[model samples]
Target: MLTQEPIYPKPFLKWAGGKTKLIQQYISLFPQKIINYYEPFLGGGAVFFYLYNHYFLSSAFLSDINPELINTYLCIKHDVEAVISLLQQHQANHNQEYYYYMRSYNTENSVERAARLIYLNKTCFNGLYRENSKGEFNVPMGKYKNPQICNPEVLRAVAKALQVAQIEVKPFETVLNYAKSSEDFVYFDPPYHPLSETSNFTAYSRDSFNKDDQIRLKNVCVELAQRGVKLIQSNSDCPFIRELYKDFKIYEIQAARAINSNASKRGKISEVLITI
Candidate 1:
């Protein structure tokens, strides 16, 4: 097996509520000699790319509950150029009518579908990937004159890095169960419990993370820590969040919200960085 090296580049995406800032702040807590890495909630793979770039692990296991997100990763790893070509076409024909038409269409594994996803993600307001009950891509187009549709270099680099790591689409419990030793480091970034009923934005999937899920995740964190797996998690800063990880080291950090469609609603928000 080829030994993994640090210095991999990041994938280009406008991931909503990404942890790029948080991870950079608390990266020192990550295990230096990571034999295996596990990320159960692989949103945009922001932390995954960071670890790959820093040479933290020889093997990585990435899992997500969202099937479409997993499909997008698979497409990038397997057929990035084709996806790029289709994304370019979507960029070329970007309009309100075209956006709705593409949003309503269902074409699995087609390059057009992947392109629409990328195009909408790049051009949509705040790169928010929310869907209605019918699961249509409904976010309005953004105001950028020339958004980057496809980054061939970033795609190739991410594809190569993912080729070396293991990828899965499963429940969080299944992925957490695999980490039973000290050689593994688990970095969890679960869907946060809303700070308030009015501020909730858990629409990544139809099933949102509730208070029960938050408790369940805390239990999983304790289990991982007891088994000696270095763990770190980021979440919304709230009384419930602090109480849940009372036993762990929680760092309160302020980060700007870059994904909200409303300009007034976009601003700095406190977050918790729990390490164990």
Candidate 2:
């Protein structure tokens, strides 16, 4: 039998609120055994990759409402070589002019779109995948001296880790249709409710996550818990979030502010990890 390299797979995309840094804090929190794993807000998927590396999954179901994000994951899972080929070309032809052009470029090809997103993500300002109100990706290019636009090794490793996974573009609530048993483990990393008005950073796509959505998510969590599906959810450590998940066992998570344009704004903050 073949084996993956010693290097564990990592999330290919640089996503806001990515859980990579906080995985250590989350390590002890995961159940000793997880048969089937579900992550609805599959952002950078740091948690999923870590769980996969530990051989904790019988099968994995990852979904996100962002179609481009899902397409990139799918392309990597199904056709990583093609995506890597395009990425190498992008890396070879990379420049400020090329970056701007690709940011505006649109295509129907799934692989091309996947490669495009990965390329832009590696080079974009702060690696943010935000969009304008008109639905166009609008983040300016970053000033990375030499960005690794194409990482074939990482891509291939991610593909291997995703072999036992089902990737989809769907709403978060849809996890109810599949994860209905105690054997299922569901992790929710939703767009966190804002801590303040000036810090409204929940915009992963055209739509911003609001208080109502957070409430709806809690309702879904309640239903899932009632059904005996083991669940863990992450959210901002704010009054509203605490009040929303008041019924569950919420733990305060110490996490660094992962992203901010201002260097001073990047500091340690509190978050919550709710479990049932």
Candidate 3:
């Protein structure tokens, strides 16, 4: 019997700092071949999904600091049908009140939580994931006339893609435990340093990624570089960041920004891609 081929899956959720647009421009910076792929801050996982679909990945290790997001990935990887079924129910009952209700809903069921997150992400304002000091998801409802709440094809595709990946909820530095020297590629897309005082939106979890965290990441990059691990990292083009990774090769590129609340602030902005 002939089996159906897995469809190429794009990012399932709309992330604030998603790299979907820059994947093309940054394509040249990606390693030609990867034995193992490591993404520590796997927001929306655009680059990981893209590379996996394109057959550029042999094995992958994906991790993030957010427990909810990691749980969603785990649900999809282990029981996509259950997640999709719950999403279908959500699609049938979607409304402003329903959105708010689901946003505040807490559940121990992995499938339900995953479905709820996908629902909120699809229907939330700008598809941005923001958490309050208490670690509660607080983004309000979006104004999309009609949102795609349940797409079975996309969910199935995502499930297929995640089969080869080992997803985890861990600190970025833990990648050192799994990655082998000279045989792995690690892509770091941590929260970018705030461009200005008002542009800070790094709170995907209750914990904030401050300047010290940035420095720690740079130190990890330095250690990985010395160990012969290939690395690619993206962050805001700022003096602090430049000095942080001064020993590596940095390339500045313009990436469009649409997550800003102010219309005037939404435009192309300079970002840096550091390689080692």
Best by lDDT: 2
Q: Model 1 scores what on Cα lDDT?
A: 0.79
**Model 2 error, position 77 (Å):** 0.9
| Per-residue lDDT of model 3, residues 1-276, tens digit only | 999875678899999899998988788988777889999999899999989977557699999989989999999999999999999999999999999999999888888989999999999999988888887899999998889998899888888889999999999999888776888899999999987788887866688899999999998998899899999999999888988888899999999999777899889999999998
Across 1-276, the per-residue lDDT of candidate 2 in tens digits comes to 899647678998888999988999998888888899999999999999999988556599999998999999999999999999999999999999999999999999999999999999999998998998888999999999999998899899999888889999999999999999898899999998999998888986898889999989999999999999999999999999888888899999899986876789899999999998
Error of 2 at 49 (Å): 0.3
Q: Assess every candidate by TM-score.
A: 0.91, 0.96, 0.96
lDDT of 3 at 89: 94
Error of 3 at 152 (Å): 0.6
Task: For candidate 1, write residues 1-276 as lDDT tens digits.
Answer: 998664355856677778776676767777778788889998888888888877745688888887777777777877888887787777778777876677677886545665667778887777877877766677777787778777777777887878867777887887566898998888888887788898788766666889988898899998889998888898999999998899999988788876655889888888888998
Q: lDDT (0-100) at residue 19 of candidate 1?
A: 77
Candidate 3 worst ten-residue window by lDDT: 49-58
Candidate achieving higher lDDT, 1 or 2: 2
Once all C-alphas are superposed, what RMSD does model 3 give against the true structure? 2.3
Largest TM-score belongs to which candidate? 2
Kindly indicate the candidate among 2 and 3 with the higher TM-score: 2
User: Cα lDDT for residue 142, model 2?
Assistant: 96
In model 3, what are the clashing residue pairs, if there are any?
Answer: none
Ranking by lDDT: 2, 3, 1
Off by over 4 Å in 2: 1-5
